[model samples]
Target: MARIVDVNPALVRQRAGAASEFLQVAEERLEFIRAESGESAEAQVAASNAIAAGISAADAICGKALGRRANDGDHRGAVELLDSVKPGGSKLALRLSKLLSDKSQLQYGGYCSAAVARSLAREARKLVEAMNEFGIRS
Candidate 1:
């Protein structure tokens, strides 16, 4: 049988607030990336970081709302947990899955291009907005 645990609204609120802060930073970094000239490598890196941070923020909000930490080394487990909470195979989950899968590649490899970075940033922004709309208190 699955164990039931009490949900802590205060903790959820705190997590939501933290997620909001991370999202703000991610947005600022994305804006910086947008303002850069001619596919700057620095901007690319910033965009990648922003996307990663935005994904983390969204995950935090999902965990808080579900009253459990949605963490797993494979990341697929986190997606499963989130899907359990907000079913229907949401777009946010799909985007997060892609971002999480590409995180290491973006951070360590030289394969990230300006166009890819911009796309990731846009997806991250959408995920953040969806989380806010989900009433995570941010």
Candidate 2:
């Protein structure tokens, strides 16, 4: 069984700050995608990376507030951890799950369209917002 440990308040604040920073970068990348009219692997990869960065920001927030870090190798583990923090099958959990599912295809192999990339960016924004709210709640 995994146990909840003590997280330093200073660390929590630091993590939250980092999350905010990442969210900003993710938003900027999303904007860049919006400015581009056509689809490209580079755009897809950027969108995917932005989503991953958003996830990382959320993970940092959850770790600080919940005192449990997600397993590095398992994206699902990160989702589970976020769920633990938010509970009740929250939208945040659902969005994270979807984004994680899309992440691999966007990053590695598969066809990623402009629409898909845009959708991922929107989801990433939502997740980042949720993380920000969670930080406030904590």
Using TM-score as the measure, the top candidate is: 2
What lDDT, from 0 to 1, does candidate 1 have? Answer: 0.60
lDDT per residue as tens, model 1, 74-121: 466656655665633366667777777777766686645556666776
The candidate 1 region of ten consecutive residues with least summed lDDT is: 1-10
**Model 1 Cα RMSD, Å?**
4.1
Candidate 2 residues 1-138, lDDT tens each? 333434566655665565556556655655555445667664676566657755665666676567766655467766767777654335677778888887767667764666776677677767666655554422
The segments of candidate 2 whose C-alpha lies over 4 angstroms from its true place after superposition are: 1-18, 34-38, 87-89, 136-138
Candidate 2 C-alpha error for residue 26, in Å: 3.6
- Estimate every model's Cα lDDT from 0 to 1: 0.60, 0.63
Q: List the residue pairs that clash in candidate 1.
A: none
Per-structure clash totals for the candidates: 0, 0
